[model samples]
Target: MANSSTNSTPGSSAREDAIRFYQIAAQRQPTPAETAAYKFIDPLAGFANCELKIFEKNSDLGGTWFENRYPGCACDIPIHNYQFTWAPYPHFPSFYTGAQDIYKYLKEVAEQHNLRKYIRLSHKIIGAKWIEERQKWQVQIVQTDGRELVVSDGETKDGEQGEPFIEECDIFINSSGAYNNWRWPTIPNREAYRGNMMHSASWPDVDYVTGRTVTLIGNGSSGIQILPAILDQADKIYVMLRSKTWVTPALANRFAGENGANKIYTDDEKENWSKDPEGYYAYRKEIENELNARFRLYLKDSQAQQMGKEATKKQMTARLSAKPELVNDLIPDFPVGCRRPTPGSGFLEALCSPKVEIIWGEIDTFNETGLKTASGKQVDSDTIICATGFNMGFVPRFSIVGLNGCDLREVWTQELPTAYLSVTVDKMPNYFVMMGPQSPLGHGSITGSIEMLTKYIRKLVSKLQTEAYASLVPREAATKAWLAHALKWMEKTVWVENCASSFKNGSSGRTVVSLHPGSRLHFFDLLEQPRYEDYEWTSLSSDPLSMFAWLADGFTAAESSAAADLSYYLVDAPHLKQRSRCAEEPTRATATGN
Candidate 1:
């Protein structure tokens, strides 16, 4: 049962990873339990395989990076860690890069992988239902030119939207990330303001901010970044914050700029990385290691947490010394990492500027001209920007009906979002999710986890394709066990503290839903291989022998072809010599955090 695929390179790309996983799997035999299940041997027939397709609501791909085009809309994560390992771009403009720069890089990766042709742009998934008879998903799609806007009032207008259509697939993967569903502020009478009002998610042109008095609300990640980006363009600005948040310093490497300073790497420095590949790898790993060691700061009342809080306060106070009143007004008493802190490079400097006005209070109401505060003060402005973020719950905005017509939106939203390892649903067969509930994407560099999860998903799909499985679904008991483990582990993390973070369910939610309750590396370890025993499966074939269908005709597709690498295993025979398991994956020492 050797794999027909000749792809030997692992961790290079998704397709290659799948091939490697299957190749490794082919050399092994099934466990005793996998061979003993009764319902698994029940009467079932074969299923059909369909062609692959991808759809994007936008005219282009880039998902959130394309959607959030606001001023100062740059990623807080360092550019080194922000990019994919498979597709490396040596020439990064700055440490904290802009959104468009990322968008372009992502597009380049897509085109390099020749994925653009498979993706159907300007098309969105509005509804999905499980068709049991067909053993597939019937997905409803809406094709658009990508100009429609869902305003604050939850209405779509002033843009063209095409009629709905249907498409079927053997498996469905939801790639719509957590932050894509941007929401407006829930303040009463939000529609009263007739000025150039915009949400941070739906940013207009920079020209819209020029020569105007701008007011920014909600000092989240976007708010902190937008203040500095608009300071030069706007004549004056008034910022309002409903609660306090911590702003972190830079991930200062030796070859970089000051904290909050976006360092544009010199051409010479960028070229040197290209020439010295090892040096660049070390540099990237250094930053990753530094971040990796910082997990101890999240522990409640730990020495690192205490020290980090004091250090962050000192940095913020010193930076905002020009306007000392802000120190007491903005600094939160909660733990430093209670919410995910952004690397707010220019935020403190912008607030210290004379042209800016900081107001810490709830918005009473919005007038035709400007906004009014609950403190009996009025701030008149030409433009009002609601840097209000999105609902971070992993629930889909569209309709999704699973087995027994179980509604995904209702199950996730009405109750709690219960996902098996944040990849598959409890009852939804053949459906997979990326960046779903209990995901570990909140830590360190997301690209690393993304790559690991890519391999994870691809491996599962490979099993389904090669094995005789019609559908796979997580058992409800397994989901409960996973969720219980998550909650118990989360008790010691900073994310469960009192804070109004997007990580939680809502303003009053204490349960952290946005991320996994473990170190980023630990999460990667869990997803290293798919756990077949954790899920329930229905084979597409009736005969028990069909499970070994991969043993097709006593010969592989590779053996039939000329110019095949028959001696490939022996070609790397020297490297294939025996190695200890501990040598392959070393055990962690319980000595220190750093």
Candidate 2:
């Protein structure tokens, strides 16, 4: 959790009003993952006897939701199923959630769980090195006062920075997601352009380009979203594309009104939800089942994939039918699920607007005025927005030196970043990562994925505490075996067989580095319990004769402490009482003194 202040972008009156309306609508309910994290942490801390600290780089709780407040920014998944399993909201304003609503929901969770105290805002970890002797990670970090840290500055901290310090921990879990590192296109003279340039990740106030021409690059989620938001306001918009990307509609309605674009909650609906939590839970379950059923589309030649491809094409064609020229320009050559499917609500319609021009070609270079295409088309613009996508380097962006000076960046540079069950790396002992290599968001909501990862992390912590282990690192063979296993399954998935997309190493690459080979269900079961045998463990105690050293003072904690219940693990006291009575009864042999 970080600072809760929202950045108010003041420019066009219409845009400002839209933002204000979103703030009000999204303020009503807590997001699922927000509630989930709170519910899990409270129980986990007590059960495992662990201290939790949440380090946030931004001045906020919602990760992408906090940063990407661009126009038409919303989740494509059903809002009900896009959260934690235990925290369902009946009073959601839409089927999908917008960024503002997401941020508010997360804030609600932090406040409700009293998680702010444990959270260190503006504290960024610069590097972490494993100390073999101490069996801990020596983490180097820098702290700021909730100001955005510059990435390209070549220094860890920004202006007027504090001294660099170190924090030691037994286990280090990297939860900074893939979207945090933004990827810039390698266009010639990119910085030399004498115009306003911005990436969708750090979208500043567009007050200067209210009625000016703007050239937006890339066709990923950000590009699709930004186009629709600025269409009516901008004088002219040029959308550059290297390759066509599949665009589909949101799976469900997120708003309340008949329009279903921007609906608010009625007082009655809100009251009903507050009073009927169980009913709302059932509703959330139904949505979850619907989402889970769609996982079949990932299969290489499944009927679901075929139907999905056809449906997406049909929908996109109809959306751009008004301007038939864009139908072919936008339709992707690859399969629908090959890459992340962009669920654009008004994107196709926006493209049909008179002011929006769709330019199809690879951007060769960026001159002082604007960029020129591969086909020698020079498109002039007063502003350029790079929605080129992310670096997708699942490896830690900062320095992480492991055993024998094995830098994580160097290892990833040589080969594909590999992890054991997408949680633990082989050499990186006591280090766990969330949303690491092979953890895909293709199957379901990322919130669900996060909770699943958290459960795995909790189990790892419990094992470390209970076993009294100094260090536990996965066997090098185990990590290789897991990757090989994932590859076998990847061979059958559409992500590998279909035409290249971001799911692959590159748009035209063969290796699928992002997606998990198995379904979300499989991942949940696989991570539920770690294979202890697969890891080479180090015991804290060195004495060979003291095998049961953990059994301190020759007594269980319950037996030693009068306040503790010895039979706490026993289930059903009545059954135990019946067994005790039977035992107390005198047998014939015992009576005869045999």
Candidate 3:
């Protein structure tokens, strides 16, 4: 991290800085990205005198973790790499932490940080419009705390509906995750064939798969995780895949104890960590370093990429040797990291089992009994689970009217959703997005990207409050130019490779939107500071001299007391001290030698 300086504000009789900021919280176990937003905004509410309101559509935080509780649901990445660097959970059940464990961690984090008080659960911001006249955003929300009335069939009963309400805010932060919207497969007669249909996003607690014929659609993360888990329970399991995905055995299964499965921490190791927190941190650093070292795997045609691809293929082939017919259909032709690699520890083994069926074809339609493949084969399934992935439109489900009443969706439709550094936009003033289009999440730990973005947001918010700016939007040229630069960089990356991945843009699925072309470290270096000249700013006052009136007599709040640290100007002058010592060190050494 780079060195930074801070000065205490001179005590002012003027009212405290009161910026009304609203954050759309993701209703899942807080990912590293959401945690970054919380860390940033929490301090702003404290010393910056900003009012914070975190709107959660669900009953709690832990966006994905809280919602998706399917059997064998666990994180793909190592737990250490998945978490915030500042906040480490040394003691977890396994290396691949389960959904409940992650959710518990996030809940603990929120409570420990005192962020729960700022959260308004069961409230969703439905729509938002930028008010050009007032220079603030008018947000429309629907609160469903006590209003939702469900029938015996789990349908919304005919009762009082949740009404939409509006609130205005100076700054709006969209921390709602990229994959928040769960989508069903575009198969015909989905409504008609009503045999226990459920998406992985909203998996019920009941075990419908056990002793039943279960059909799973789409071979994404959810599908991969659910396969091995229900193999023993389900009498028959049919996994339908439209395309092949590379299942690498790089990550270990916590339970399997095979194919690079995570090593269990022995009692001695735990005792050692308990004795020394620094040692535990050092151990985590070792894991993090190993994760970062694999960045070269993303580089197309690199040696690391080739090695990874081969290793994955070998492991997958070995595991599926029992079923020679399915091996060819299971292994992908593309490189391992072309799409996100799913760990295939027990997954490959499960495919070889007689109880499982790997259907490698497009679906024709769904009947009242089961589904029919395009090859004229009917697969009988009592329960159809659509692990078909989320609706990654990249745009908000609710409408967002920007300048001149132009919808944000319309602008993105004109051209793919592009933003300045994937955060600030051209027309969207005083609006910021977390994990926006072209966010740096393709490689390495996503937490690093989140932390970098949070720091940038902190500076942007500080500038807005201190400079008395009515609003700030990136220059159209700057945003466009950055987008161009991003496209150029993406040309060399594997993300643009012809593969079906969530990183692709919207329904088109050709343009990559969710990932950065560069490494996480590169993004961190780039976003260390903002180029103020790149933004178009508006002042509250028309007079040029009065533009900085918010500065208030050129004195900070801490400067009111005479006994305050007057010589604090040199607090960040460590370099000067180092230089002085260096200058005298040679002289002293020469005299001592004589």
Candidate 4:
């Protein structure tokens, strides 16, 4: 639980309006015990007791806090709504916290839950392989200090150089997040440019705009935030748009009310919000309804029958005409949602600056001094920033060989990545993906999704330990059926039809990463518990103690000719290998490199 001061009012000199907006939006009060029954489940308590490990590549927690460190990087979701219901933070200040606050909150959560001990900071996971003999996963991780950490050891530390390492675990969880792995377009001579260049994910620490000509590529969220700030420092700022971006106006607020609504809420206001059951409920429902209604209107009016491309064009034209010179280049040919909508506080105003220029053209190539456009025009610049997003479509960059040498990535490559309830993989046993493909909640805060997933994972681990199960893997048929339903559900949603956003497929031209059309509550309810029927459990009961001992010792009936001839042994065999000595010999041969 968070401290009481978080809900208190701000000081007089502070911004009261922003603080109040966040308070209403966050719905910071706790739910009734009945509503939060799952939080008290002993399964999570037990799971938390066990040693956990998280593999992270960077210093920051997620993409939101990692890449977009621009001057005005702030969350759009109200601060209260963004928090995890189970682990509430009473100290959180506003509804829409800036990047620094978000980072602080993540650190605070880690501290509160004692999760820092579990995280393997600056370690990159290269590969994971399932050892059928041990019925455990061998995770291969490379640390920043160039040391390999294997799970077999209770703790990972600096070991002798060139020594092999592996970590053995009953389960695996991937929370690599959506962005931070930068992806640059395949433009000719893009690397040959003799100018300062940086990706939005890896922003340079030094001053980038000291009254020099600057070119910013890509008009996504980061671009919107950067353009306005850079205009104040740069002599000439050129915003290069490879594709049209949807610009949505953002609502900015300031504090003007009495009381320190600007500094922090008073003790009374905090208590009122937390303890008043009816008032909290009403306020929460109101915010949820408002957000839902806005989403509905956006989706409804986006249809061809309502406001088609012509209407979008007209709206964009009017917006661009505010700065006539930008009209020729800033307007896009695609639909508004075809890409991610960029919300801006001063994007339109920034473009109206005489020093700013918008270039709407394709880059032919980058020469030593400047970029050459498709129209044979050359734009000179002293510095170039590649704001083009990440490679989300290509996930699990490492190969995962599960039971029977089945490659998990290979299976997903043949079809869109799908899972049983978006957590368990079909052939991959005991492997849990935190936010797998098509499971991202684009309309809500990802922190909410993470909390929900943590609950689900806790339950799964409990089932495994309680059942004395050797391994648990998703039933192939169940996963196939679930994926079919998921694809069908996505077809009815706006993400598939609206935009050419990276959340969808770039090659096949389909939306496969984000969630299907549904409310956040709907997805939350579905993921609340694990559907047991969708999985196949393998246990010790399947084989007696003596038989299990023999299996554990790497012995098979084929090794003993007398036992091999017994039909009773073959009857209990899990696979066909017991009947064929020659077929089984190859497994041993491959294991020993014979």
- Candidates in order have lDDT scores of 0.71, 0.69, 0.72, 0.58
Taking all chains together, each candidate's TM-score versus the true structure is 0.85, 0.86, 0.88, 0.72
lDDT of 3 by residue, 1-594 (tens): 111111213332254433423333332225643564466556643324466667776667777777788887888887766776766777676667789988898888787777677677767666788998888888877776543211111122232147878878877777777655777788898877868888888787787988999998878888888888888889999989788888877552322344666555567766777788898888777777777677888878989888888887787788779987777887777667777777744787887899987787899999888889999999888899888877665666667787888788678767778878988887888777877887875675577677777778778876766666778999999988888888888777677787878776323244676777587777778888799999989876666766545655455645666787867767476588887887877877687996
**Runs in model 4 lying further than 4 Å from the true structure:** 1-49, 59-68, 87-95, 146-164, 249-286, 292-321, 324-336, 505-508, 511-513, 544-594
**How many clashes in each candidate?**
2, 3, 17, 29
What residue runs in model 1 are displaced by over 4 Å at the alpha carbon?
2-50, 146-160, 252-256, 543-594
The better-scoring model by lDDT among 1 and 4 is 1
Q: Lowest-scoring 10 consecutive residues by lDDT in candidate 3? A: 1-10
How would you encode candidate 4's per-residue C-alpha lDDT over 1-594 as one tens digit per residue?
A: 001111222221211111000000000011111111233222444342244555554443443564457665666655555665555554445444567776676666656755455555555566788887777788876555432222111133433224335777777665555554556766799878998887776666787777789988877777777787688888998888765565643211122112111134457655776777566556545555555444432243445414544554564556566676665566655445455555554676688888987776788999888798898988899988777777665346667889889887787778677767767887887787755765754655566666676677667665555334567888989887877787777665556654457667433365565563456666678878678878888763444342222123233324445645544544555655665876656787688989
Identify the superior model by lDDT, candidate 2 or candidate 3: 3
Q: Give the TM-score of candidate 4.
A: 0.72
- In candidate 3, stretches whose alpha carbon ends up further than 4 angstroms from where it belongs are 1-29, 32-38, 41-47, 145-160, 251-258, 264-271, 505-510, 556-558, 571-594
Best by TM-score: 3
Clashing pairs in 1: 45-540, 260-345
- Across 1-594, the per-residue lDDT of candidate 1 in tens digits comes to 233222222222212111212111000001111111111121131112324466666667676677788888987877887776655677888888899888888777666756555567666667888888777888887666665332211134223376888887777777666666677787777788888899899987557688888999888889988999889999999988778889876754343476556789899989999999888989888878887877778889889899889988988898888989888988998898888777787898899999988887888889888888899788888888988888777777677899999989888878778688888898788887766788875676666776566567656766666554677898889999999888888889788888988778446467876678788888889998788899898776555645544443445546655988776666454545444544675456623433
